[model samples]
Target: MSNQDSEPEIDNSDLEGNSRSQSSFGDAIEDQEDELGSSESGEQKSVTSDSSEDEEQNEIIRTGAMIQQSKGRKINKNERITPPFITKYELARVIGTRALQISKNSPIYVDPKDSIDPITIAEQEFNENKIPFIIRRYLPNGNFEDWELQELERLD
Candidate 1:
């Protein structure tokens, strides 16, 4: 086939349709305003009380007053939130007190040179960059900061 036969045919109606509405922008705008005014002036009937009352009664009570908060990343049971690596300051605190304690009421026996405390090792690893570990403690002490050399908190 020749190039002329290959070319797509344009619809003649589209060209005529566009030409029909080819009025000037100002004329088109003025025509729209005139149509609006004619519709408004055509009817002077006042709104009936019954129609207005029904509209007010039929008002939809939408339960959409709640603030739409942006969604965050979802957490699944298969997923876990890893805590930020402990810093040097945090490590020292855990090793010297929390990890060292054998009993809450009893005094702690801690020897940094030969200590097998998981918390101490974890803390040291976190702060000093020793090695990654999976630590497990049956009883976790929650009183390291309570009685430390730092004396950070004042208990009255």
Candidate 2:
């Protein structure tokens, strides 16, 4: 009458609709073996093999003798460079961050208006293209280029 009554009832009715098929290690083992070549024994092995397979599976082989041959693409140094326009996503991110700063009492680089909304001020600065900032562009080769805001036009 004490412990039984104190226990809360659990409702699993919602979980019935969310039931999923049982997952197996077949996919994981196949993926690992494909990425990492079979052991020195020269026969295909499962995930239950010795610790050597496990260690090899953990290490990523980008350039080595053990590197697995894949039909994937190689790095193209002459890949098309990004256009000289600021992407919409980057513009949104910068404006959102600047708006937050303005809301927190940060001084606006542009003139203030009768209304004190930070988002509005940020939008105004963006529309007038007066935001003195740098647009950092990341290349696929792990190098980055900093572009002046004036030099790059807004895509939208």
lDDT of each: 0.37, 0.59
TM-score of 2: 0.46
Q: Residue 48 error for model 2, in Å?
A: 46
Structural similarity to truth (TM-score) of each candidate:
0.18, 0.46
| Residue runs of model 2 more than 4 Å from their true location after superposition | 1-80
Q: What tens digits encode model 1's per-residue C-alpha lDDT throughout 37-114?
A: 998999776864311343442212111122322232223324433232333443454454444343243233333457
Clashes of 1: 0
Candidate 2 lDDT over 71-155, as tens digits, reads: 2233233453656777777777667876887899976778867868888898888788766655545444444444555666876
Evaluated at residue 46, the lDDT of candidate 2 is 64
lDDT of 2: 0.59
Model 2, position 32: C-alpha lDDT score? 63
Give the CA lDDT, 0 to 100, for residue 70 in model 2: 34
